[model samples]
Target: MLILLNILSGVALLVWGTHIVRTGILRVFGAELRRVLGRSANSRLRAFGAGLCVTSLVQSSNATAVLASSFAAQGLLLLAPGLAIMLGADVGTALMARVLTFDLSWLSPILLLGGVVLFLTCKQNRAGQIGRAVIGLGLILLALHLIVEAAQPVMQGEGIKVLFGTLTGDSMLDTLVGAAFAMLSYSSLAAILLTATLAASGVISLKVAVCLVVGANLGSGFLAAIGTLGQNAAGRRLALGSLFFKLAGALLVLPFAPYIARGLSFLIANPRESVVTFHLLYNTLRCLASMPLIDAVARLCHRMLPDRADANPELRPLYLDPGALSTPTLALANAAREALRIGDIIRTMLDNVLELMRTNNAEQARATIRLDDDVDQLYTAVKIYLARISREQLDEADSRRWTDIITLTINLEHAGDIVERVVTNIQEKKILHRLQFSPAGLGELEDLHARVVANLQLGLSVFLNSDLKSAERLLAEKERFRDLERSYSYLHLDRLAGQSQRSLETSALHLDIISDLKRLNSLFCSTAYPVLDAAGALRDTRLRRRVLDATYGKDAA
Candidate 1:
C-alpha cells in the first residue's frame, strides 16, 4: 500500500515535470517554430525538421503532433510539411527516450544547474533556447525515475501480473489492449514509459511489452486525428498520414515481432523505450518507404476530404483540447496565427471598399458586404479563442500576445465598423442619391485608394517575409495615405463652397468618406505596430521612441 501511494505521487510528479518541460521550451522558441510552419508549403522535409525540433524542445511528441495538426487544419501549414513533421517527430521522441534510458541522474543536475544559470543569467535568445534544452532534458530524466518507481511494485502484484499476462499474450489482443490503455491513461507517453520500466525490471516479457508499445503509438494518433476532424482537406490528409503511418507500421511489425523485441532488448529496458523504438522505426521506415510516394496518401486523403468543401473548420481556439492547454507558448503562437487571419480578411474588405468606389461595380459591392460579414464571424470566433487563452496561465511573451490578441480583435471589429460605414453611409448613399463625383473628385479618391492598397500589401508582405525594410515602407505609405485623404477632403470642401449650386448629398458623402479614409489609415498604422513588436523592434528604445513620437506625436498635434 505504501508503495502504491508513492507510485501515485511519482505519477503526479511526472505530469508536473512534463508540463514544466513543454511550456518552458515553448516559451523560448514557439515564435520561431510558428514562422517555420507558416512558411513551408510544398516542402515535406522542412516540415519534418520542424516536427523534430518542436517535439525535442517540448519533450512531448503528442503535443507537437497536435500543434502541427491544428495549424494544418487551419490552412497555415501544408499537408506535406505536416507529414514530414510527423515523421521527424517519431525520431525526436525516440531520441528523448534513449537519452532518458541512460543513467543520467548525475547529468540531470549538471544540465539543470547550467540551464538555471543560463535562463536566469542571460538576456539573449540563444541562452533561452539552451536553458529550455537543459530543463527539457532534466525533466525527461526526473519523469523517467518517478514513473519507474511508481510502476515497480505494480509488477509485484499478483492480480496485476495475471492481468498483464492475459492482456499482452496475443499480438492482436495486446495491440488492442495497449491502445485502449494508452487512450484512457491521460498520458500515452507515461503509459509506455511505465511499461518500459516493467520490462527493464523483467516483470513483463519483451513480447508483451512490444504489444503495449504498438498500442501506445496508435493511441497517440487519435489526438492528431481529432484535431484535424473539422479542418480543411490538407489538414485531414495530414491527420490521415499520421494515423496511417502509426497503424500500418504496427501491423507490419506484428509478423516480425520476435526479432524486433530482441533488437530493442539489446539497447534498453522499459516499455517506454520499446514504445519509443516502435515509434521511431515506424515513422522512419514508413517515411522512407512512402515519403517518395506521399502523393498517393495525399491524393487518397484529398478524395476523402476535398478542397472545395467549405466546411466550417472548427478550432477550439481555447481548450480546443485539454491535452494542449498546458503548453502556453505554442497555444499563444497559435492564437497569433489566428489573429493574422483576422487581419488578412480585413485587408480584403478594404480592397472591396476601394473596388466599389472605383468601378461602382454592383457585384464587387455585394462581395464586400459578404466578405465583411465573414470577417465579423471570424472576429467573434478569434475573440472567443483569445479570451479563453487569456484565462489560462501564461508566461510573459504569451501574456503579451494575449493582450495583443484582445486589442487586435477589437481593432478588427472596429475595421468592420468602418467598412460597414463605407458600405452603408458612403456606398449605399452614393448609389441611392444617384450622386456622381465630379471628375476631379473621382481622381483624388483614386489616389487615396492607391495608397490604401499599397499599405495593405505592405502589412501582409511584412508579416509573410518578416522584412524589416517593409516596416518603414508601410509606415511611410500610411502617412502618405493620411496626407492624401486630408488633401482630398479639403479639395471636396472647397469645391462645394465655391460652387453655389453644389448638391448637399455629394458634400455629405465626401465628408463621411474622408473620415472613413483617415480611420483606415489609423488602423493601417496599428496593424504594423504589432509586427514591429514581434520583430523585437518594440524593445529597441531608440526605434520604439521614434515610432511612438511619430505616431502619437502626429495624433497629438
Candidate 2:
C-alpha cells in the first residue's frame, strides 16, 4: 500500500509540474507564440513547424492546441493548417518525452535551487515566470526518479506480477490500460514514461510497452478533445480532426506492435530506450506521412461538427475564451476584442437613434434599446473574465493593459446606456408628444449626431491601436464638440426669442437631445485619455493657476 501511494504521489507531482511548466512558459511567451501561430496560415509546413517549436517550449501539446484553437475560433487560422499544427504538436510532445527519459538526476538539485532563488526574488516579472518553468523541470526530473524507485518494489509483489502477466499476451487490454493511464494523468508524455519505466523493471514485456505507446498517443488526442469542450465550433473541429488522425494511427499500428517491438529490440537491447525511441520515430513518421491528408481530414471534421448559428448572435461574447485566462496577455487581448463588440453595438444604437428621430419609428427605437442589454451582458462577462486572471501573475505592462481594457469596456457600456436613453428621450418626448423641431434646429441636431458617430468610430480605433496622433485628434475633437454644443444652445435660444413656432413647441426636447449628443461624444472620446496621459501629453488640470492666484492667493493656487 505504501509503495502504491508513493507511486501515485509521484505521478501527481509529475502532473503538477507539467501544469506549472505550461503556465509559466505561456505567461512569459504567450503573446509571441500567438503571433507565430497567427502568421503560420500561409503554409502547412510553416504551421507544423510553429506548433512543434511552441509545444517544445511549453512542454505540453495541450497549450499549443489552445493557442491554435483560439486562432481558428477568431478566423485567423484555417482548418487544414490547424490540423497540421496538431500533428507537429504530437511529434513535439514525443520528442520531449524522449528527452525527459534521459538520466538527468545530477541536474535536478541545481535547477531546483536556482529556480527557487529566482522565483522568490523576482516574483512578478518575466524572470519569475522563467524560474517557475525551471522549477517545474526540476520537479519533473525528481518525480521520474521517484516513480521508478517506487514502482520497482510494487511490481515485485506477487499480485502485481500476476496482474502484469495478464497484459503480456492481451495487446488490446494493454492498450486500454495505457490509454486510461494517459487520460488519468492528463499527459501522454507522463504515461509513456511510466510505461517505459515498468518495461525496464521487467514487470511488462517489450511488446506490451509498444502497444501502450500507441494507446498513449491516442489518449493525447482524447485529452485535447476534452480540453476543447468549451471552445467554439472551429476549435472543436480542430480537436476532432486531430483525434481522428491519432485514432487512425493507433489502429494501423496496434496490430503490428509485436513486430515493431521485435525490430526495436534488435537495434537496442534496453527495453526503456526501445520504448522511448519507438515513440519518437512513430510520431515523426506518422505526422510526416499524414501531412498530405490534412485538408481531407479538416473537411471531414467540419462536416461532423458544422458551425451552428446563434439565435441571438449579438448577445454572445465571441472572444472571451475561458481557456485564455491562464495566460494573462492572451486573456487581455480576448477581452479587448470583446469590448470592441460593445463599441460596435453602441455605434449601431447611435445610428438607430438618428433614424428614429427622422422617421419617428417607435418600434425601431425599442429594438435598439434592447441592444443595451446585450452590452450589459457582455460587460459583465468581460469584467468577470478579467477578474479571474490572477493579478500577481501580471507584469507591470500587462497590469496597465488590464486596467485600460476595463476602462474601455466601462466607457463603452456607459455609452451604450447613454445612446439607449437618447433613443428613449426621442421616442417619449418627441414622437409621443407629436412635436417637431424647426428645419434649422433639426439640421443642427443631425450634424451633431453625425459627428458623434464619427467620433465613436475613431474612439474604437484609438482603443485598439493606441496611436498618439489619433488620440490627440480624438481629444481635440472632444473640445470642438463641446464648443459646437454651446453654440447650438445659443442658436436655439435665438430662435426662441424670434418666436419660431416649431422651436417654441419642441424647444426643451431639442436642447435635451443636443445635451445627450454632447455627452455621448464625451463618452466615446474617453478612450483617448489613457493614451494621452501615458504619453505625458495631457495636462493634470484644465483650470488656470494664474487665475486662481489672482482670485485668491498663491496658497490657493
| Winning model by TM-score | 2
What lDDT does model 2 reach? 0.87
Query: Per-residue lDDT of 184-287 in model 1, one digit per residue for the tens?
Result: 65455656666666676656778777777777778777766775566555666787887887777788888877787788778765555565666556656766
Best by lDDT: 2
Every candidate's CA RMSD: 5.4, 4.4
Write the residue-wise lDDT of candidate 2 on 230-345 in tens digits. Answer: 87889889989998988888888998988998999899999899999999999999999899898789889988999998889887788988889889989998999998888888
- After superposition, candidate 1 runs with Cα above 4 Å error: 35-50, 109-136, 146-160, 184-188, 255-287, 311-344, 355-366, 390-405, 455-490, 497-505, 526-557
Off by over 4 Å in 2: 151-155, 433-436, 537-557
- As a whole number from 0 to 100, the lDDT of residue 20 in candidate 2 is 85
